[model samples]
Target: MIVVGVDGLRPGVLAVEWAAREAVVRAVPLRLVNVVPAWCLHDGPTGAVADIGAWMRNGGKSALAEAAAAARRVVGTVAVETSLLGGDPRRELIEVSEDADLLVVGDSGMGALRGLLVGSVALGVAGHAHCDVVVVRASAAGPRPEVVVGVDGSAAQTAVLDFAFREAAVRDAELRAVTAWNWRDPLGGPEASERALAEALAGRREIFPDVRVRTEVVEGSPVDVLRHAAAQAGLLVVGSRGRGVLAGMVLGSVSQALLHVAPCPLVVVRGR
Candidate 1:
């Protein structure tokens, strides 16, 4: 099943709805989840913890019903279910993600201060989710759907490419394979860098034989280059991190930045 985390059925709910429709069309079950913060409890004598819990449950059901209705309008009939959870939104999402085929969430919510800051829930899920996570921004639109995958010639990149190609196939969109190299090192000339990129992309051609594949070798920061390229893409896919454990632990700067500024939906694949 594809699990989507909803926060009060905000405007960003549309993104997850759209993704749910996509999932339905693919014949996957869609589950809408709402997590009420644990702090909603009242510790004082006047605190109405029971009342608050009841309200949250009722609200959760209503939100799920609305989501289901919206999804039906687009998908006709699909296996859909809803749930209300308690505790930290991020932590709950991570736990629920365990059984999810794809976990979806909004990029930023009601308190967003900037375009670059993914909501805390999204950040936590992107960092620890055991499944694929799709971060959808409210400002995102259009359907020119192109799959943009970041490659840095690491074993982890193979997983990224695999996911990108498969998504492009499912979406019937163009697959763009990108590699960004820093030119600060004079020892590796532009020609050498270009050669390396070509080699990396060349290794993935067989998997995407019928898909229209394009390769880009840019000479700038990976994050900047990727964000620029993602402007016209429908989906931007990248590994949870990159080449080494350090990159994974720190969150690949490129993926982090793209999650914030990319104009399209971002998919972060999690694994070693």
Candidate 2:
């Protein structure tokens, strides 16, 4: 199933709509989830506190209802399910990711303030989720028929290629695999990057022969290269960590940076 977190916010509704369309393409069920903060509920049995808790629960249910309706509007015959959860939003969503094929959330969560590029919940879950996590953002140019992916000869390269190809095939979009070459690195030049990109995607073409692919090796920062390439793409897919990132880090610096600036929805695939 595709699980999407909805808070009734504009970005949250966009996430639901994206997930609904993805469900239809993948032929899976869509699950809309709204999580009430634990702080809203009280341990004591005070009447006022009880009333406030009830109000919060009701609000969460209403949000779920609206999310379900929005999903149905996107695809009326989609199998959609709604859930009202109570706990830490990040933890709850991460747990939900275990059973989900894809877990999606809005780039900005509720209580978003000016200058806050990405929401804490979205970042938290993206870094810790057990499965792939997609952070949805509205693109200025609207949806395009292309999926861009970052390719580095890292241990996670295979998984990243698999995801990029699958997504391209499902969306019937072009797959653009990009590799960034650092000029300072003598051993790994543009030529090396190109070879790595080709080798990483060697057999994926056969698996997804229908997906039109274009590969490039540009010399620059990984984040900057990918951000420009995905300016008009429908989706941007990358591994949780890149070759340059330390293994101890749950989220690579490049992936984290792109999450804040990528033009389209970004999917962080966990390395298996």
Candidate 3:
């Protein structure tokens, strides 16, 4: 099943949008997770604590019902479920992700209590989730019809590219494969970038020729370039840096940028 974390009263509209779409594509059910405070778990479920627990559950049910209603608006007829857990949203969401096929959350300018669902909580889940995670930053400029993916000449990218192509095919949208062009090196300029991107796309054509692919070589940091491309696309795909860290070249930086500032849904693939 596809799972999404909602902020309850405030909610994350873009997250619901992605969860609905992804559930439709995967032919799976959608699960919404709402995490409240941990006061009752520590204080025990008795007396005044029991009253508070009921209140928390009521609020959680209300919030989850709102999120489920919003999801229904998108996919029309799909199975949607919800769970209300106590404790920190960040830790609780990581646990919720254990059984999820894809985890979807919102980008809520985290760092404060009000933004718990999308901020630090969302980022932590995306970075550490065993399953694939999608962070949604609502698109303000109407509907974007295409999907953009950042592809560098790095290991495991073929797997990530395959993930992007599959989503593009599911959306029946145009796929743009973007790479940061290095102009300082004369040997690996635009021509080099073109070749690398072509090689990356080579064998995949036979598998997903129906996916209209557009390759680009932009002269800038991968984070900046991919952000620009994602601003106009419906979704942005990138591979996690795994363990290593690279400044502007690796997706570690790109993922950081897009996780907070992207205009569309961002998918960070952890595996092929």
Candidate 4:
């Protein structure tokens, strides 16, 4: 099933809509989840504390109902479910991700402080979730027909390619496979970048014959190149780790950078 976090904000609403369409394309159930802080559930010495707890719960329920309605409006036949969870949003979402095929969350939060970039919960879940995490953002323009993916010549490229190709096929969009090489590095050039991309994509085209792929090898930072390409893409996909990332790192610098700057929804395909 596909799971999405709901917070009664525009980004959250958009996330639900995106997840609903994805559910229809994948023929899976869509689960809408709303998380309440664990502290909100406790009854303090003051009676007002209990009232505040009740208020939070009511708000959560309302948000879930609205999200569910929005999702149904996207596709009436889609199987949509709602869950009201309590605890830390990051922890709850990571646990939920264990059972979900995909986990989606809004790029930002409700208020000014949280609205700056990606919310803390979204970033945390993206780093630790058991399944692929998609940080959904509001598309600035109309429907985009291209899906961009960053191939870093890492072992995780397999998962990145698989996810990118599947997403492109499901959306009936073109897949643009991009590889970037830093110009300042003596060992790196266009030829090396092309060779890495070719090696990674070898024979994978046969698995996704219907997907139309355009490979690009550019000289620049991976994050910079991928961010530029994502301007015209509906979705930007990347692996959690890249060739330059250390084995102990959970989320690579490139993936984290794009999560904040990608103009489209960013999918971090974690190695399983």
Candidate 5:
């Protein structure tokens, strides 16, 4: 498991919480990574042209230290590792994701405008990482007991279902599997949409017998339905294609809308 490390704002601490939660669940070590611009090596603390990258390296180390401490507090001192990636932050994170079991990131800010604008690094990594990605936002007032996932019947559907079921099992929470379509005469009718949702989750039940799943087929936009369902959820899981033009985009919306609207943590599964 891996978590993004940064200096300030909610992500650093939030990432630690989420990554630590998974670490506890999977009994795995957590790795914290901070990506720095390679050019930072030229920046000097004395305002000089360059500091041989010492400043950047030290900064990364400090962030990793804070993140590690937070994770220990959250998961009662679990095994943790740290690393620093040079060059483009987004590219480096994507590379780190290739070997990580899961990747967690924080939204740049909490303001509506800020949240809506997914950081370029987060956007890039979410779309390209080989592992699953979870983006944390808004603090919770209390514990939420449900995990919601979207089913689009795309190639990514299986991975999304598996991820949702596994997470629900891990959290001992109810899984709400949702599918939405534009309301119309037939193609968008509730019956057909409900059947599609059932088909999409067909064999997944056998695979995850312990997970209790409730299916929902609503006549509305996919993102809107998902946003509504996630109102009381602890996590919202969605699927995205990590390759080509759709890279990092969640449900054709680029992850901006939900990241801004959903009051819970958002997990964007990189689909096969």
Candidate 6:
């Protein structure tokens, strides 16, 4: 099942709907989760404290019901489930991601502009979640979306490529395999670079024998190359680990930059 976390269900509703529809098309179950802040039900010294708490809970439940109904509308006959959680959104999402095949969340929520500079829930889940994480931006438009994945010739990248290829085949969209190289060491020689590129793409032709596969080997930063590629893509997928990010608590440079600047929605495949 693909679990989608909806916080307040604002601007993210469209992206969540699109993701749920994609899951339905893949014949996977869809689960919608809404996290309610505990402070919303806190009892203050003001009069009618109990009444206010009850009202807040009721409002939260109503909003969750509406989000669930909207999801059902987008996904015709797909299996759907809804849950209203109370606590930190990231913690709740991580707890639920245990049994899920994919976890989806919006890049940012309502009132997030003044609150968080970079989307926290998406980054948190992408960094620590055991399952694949899909972070949808506010301006994403769906329908036969394209899949873009990064390849760095690492074992983790192989898993990312496999996932991207399968997703492209299922969606009947183009899959772009990208590799970024920097010409820092001139003594490395072009022959070694060519051999490395070939090895990176080798042994993967059988995965998409008939699908369109395009590779790019450019001389620049990975983040810049990926951001450029993301301009024309519908979805961008990348591995959790790469040649960047020393601490490993967050996404690498390319993935992190794309998360904030990608023109389309982004997916960070974890545990690959």
Q: C-alpha displacement of 92 in model 2, angstroms?
A: 0.7
Q: When superposed on Cα atoms, how far off is each prediction in RMSD? A: 3.1, 1.8, 3.4, 1.9, 3.7, 3.0
TM-score of 2: 0.94
Poorly placed runs, candidate 3 (over 4 Å): 9-11, 41-53, 109-118, 184-187, 242-251
Which tens-of-lDDT digit does each residue in 1-272 have in candidate 6? 88887766554676568667878777888888777676555656365766776776786677667777778788767677888777877888899999988988877842255556356777777787879888777765444366777877654776787788888887788877777776663424445555665676677767577667777766667778777777768788888777544863466766666677766777887863
TM-score of each: 0.87, 0.94, 0.87, 0.94, 0.85, 0.87
How well does candidate 5 match the true structure in TM-score terms?
0.85
lDDT of each: 0.74, 0.86, 0.77, 0.86, 0.72, 0.72
- Candidate 5 residue-wise lDDT, 95-160, digit = tens: 777778887777662111343455555666666777888877645612678999888766777788
Mark the 10 consecutive residues where model 1 has the least summed lDDT. Answer: 38-47
Better of 1 and 2 by TM-score: 2
Instruction: Kindly list the per-residue Cα lDDT of model 1 for residues 92-153, writing each as its tens digit.
Output: 88898899878888887323446446776777788888798888877655467788888776
Against the true structure, candidate 5 has what lDDT? Answer: 0.72
Candidates 3 and 6 compared by TM-score, better number: 3
Which ten residues in a row are the worst by lDDT in model 5? 109-118
Clashing pairs in 2: none
Between 2 and 3, whose lDDT is larger? 2
Off by over 4 Å in 5: 3-5, 41-47, 51-54, 109-116, 184-186, 241-251, 254-256
lDDT of 4 by residue, 135-229 (tens): 98765522678999998877788889999998999888999999888777544788877887888887888988999999998878888999888
